[model samples]
Target: MTDRVAIVTGGSGGIGRAVSERLAADGISVLVTFSGGSQRADDVVTAITDAGGRAVAARADVAEPAEVNALLDVAEAEFGGVDVVVNTAGIMRLSPLAQLSLDDLDAMYRVNVRGTFVVSQAAVQRLRSGGALINFSSSVVKLALPTYSAYVAGKAAVDGITRILAQEVRGRDITVNAVAPGPTATPLFLDGKPTEVVEHLAAQAPLERLGEPKDIAEAVSFLAGPARWVNGQVVYVNGGIV
Candidate 1:
């Protein structure tokens, strides 16, 4: 028998790609999932397989139960069984509460909060013993940035789910946790920020630089393997930006 298998939602995105690659390097087969970026998803699969690891690309809208179920099917059929699920998939639309659109808030909830719930629900049912479920929260939940009210609200919900899910799976020996990363250099983080704003945020970290996707991946790796005692916790992967 092989080692554990993993499903990395948003595996095509910056942080997702780094995590997929990292887990694959740890000798796990991965199902790299994407909602819209098929080409990017394929690229991630290729990167993993090219490096002598096993991986497959699957498309899934985490908010849709049918699609997520199908994705889990693919992982099980291809890799034997699922042991870890890393829900790094999310969308962020920033606006101060006064001007925030309900539509944007709804979209964020669908993918961030509801999506995590949907996936975790399924993962708890199917994950083999000693499995792990990891979700993504954000440092913004603590930072309380002005324009991030909606996005941070969604992440705060994720934090809640992570804690509750950890307790819900009490006898199952499955670890549920969340990684709250500080400002990282990914497309999602850098998309709209000006260069000066980016520089300022990067300098805010005690490490005096923006975290890389690989840095966040390291945190995920720890949770997925050799960190059995660490459960029901939200790890801040930020470099002392609390």
Candidate 2:
């Protein structure tokens, strides 16, 4: 993959960082995009560079089509072309269906659904012939957990888009797929949950613990690299939770 250029959104945190590092390790020139955490993004780039990998950090809000396009422009200018695009930027909120507000729904959709769409659209335009688009979904779509209706719904849309996108780009060598992870041990998973609640959630998984960011990243690496036959599918990396 040394000849490839990759763009990973939300590259400052958890799964995004792992994905960026893994791709960089594989000899792909990585563009790490962050929304607000420029320091953390730079840290990731530094880590990769220190390890003898090529990478750059840029700030962009994936929800805005303009920003997404600009991010592509930067990647193209720096790396010559984009061969892989990973959309890992998303948000979540816990609320019962009755208590879920429209604002909450819109907020989640804006970042999760709309953001993935915009980023994927931009990538499709500039992606090389053998390009791959890996999008983030969630195991909650299959687990059907309560209080995650809005978040899961948004991911479901990503799943749908992934399938249709593959067909749309059928003639091209580009492949589109979604990776749905179970409860990963990220800051986002820890937020708003009590210690006991977090433990219980972890234990609920069949593997007896929550997933690691690298676990999901491994799947992403396969899809972005040698797993070209795997397209238009949602590969769940939830440690058998779903």
Candidate 3:
């Protein structure tokens, strides 16, 4: 953990931006990877850099092994070594299990499931001892919400991978865990939902509000830094929703 470098995929998005910035605030160098929203990603880097933090932006498709490997190589060459890798790159298409298109499910699986696999495979090689790998899961798995079967199916797979990988890396000093976020105020969650629906979900939480990106980022910051003892766990940041 000499350099304390972190590679955050989908680093342009709301939660990703917060995580990158928070980790940088903690004195960790960040390698932000984005597939789109290049300008947004650059803005995050600039914010971190202006604050005297080290950060760089790169393009990588989390689903592609070569691209993911190249992205990690960028971190190694630029920041020395990777201490944390957070997979936040994912897409969701809402549809009932019966009406869901195979294409939508396929696309989500490619980016969400295979993407996690590709990145984790690289982490399996690149992450040093004492390093941590954080994967994103959804509280929907436990909520058992309808029209989420396909998305939940993919995330359910992530849950399995997180658990098995934790055990597989037994002696390695590496901690593998999944951060299951409840309905948060990210484009991924807010988009396509009506205000009433959003409000309904928000009120369901014990906290009586939606989670901010900073809230979720705080969780990742803890896991990536001081929460070394918390491994193979699904820490839900859903404000006591489930």
Candidate 3, residues 102-191, lDDT tens digits: the string is 999999999999999999989978898889999999889999898999999999999999999999999989999999999999999999
Q: What is the lDDT of residue 52 in candidate 3?
A: 92
Go through the candidates in order and give each one's C-alpha lDDT.
0.93, 0.92, 0.92
Candidate 1 to truth, TM: 0.98
Assess candidate 2 and give its TM-score to the true structure. 0.97
Strongest candidate by lDDT: 1
Q: Which portions of model 3 miss their true places by more than 4 Å?
A: none
lDDT of 3: 0.92
Q: Which ranges in model 2 have alpha carbons more than 4 Å from their true place?
A: none
lDDT of 2 by residue, 69-165 (tens): 9998999899898999999999998899999999989989999999999998888888899899999999899888889998989999999999999
Candidate 1 lDDT over 1-242, as tens digits, reads 14899999999989999999999999989999999959999999889888999999999999988898888899999988999999999999988899989999999999999999999998999999989999999999999788998899899999999999999999989999999999999989999999999999999987899999999999999999888999999999999997
TM-score, candidate number 3: 0.98
Clashing pairs in 2: none
Error of 3 at 203 (Å): 0.3
Q: After superposition, how far is residue 178 of candidate 3 from its true place, in Å?
A: 0.4
Candidates sorted on TM-score, descending: 1, 3, 2
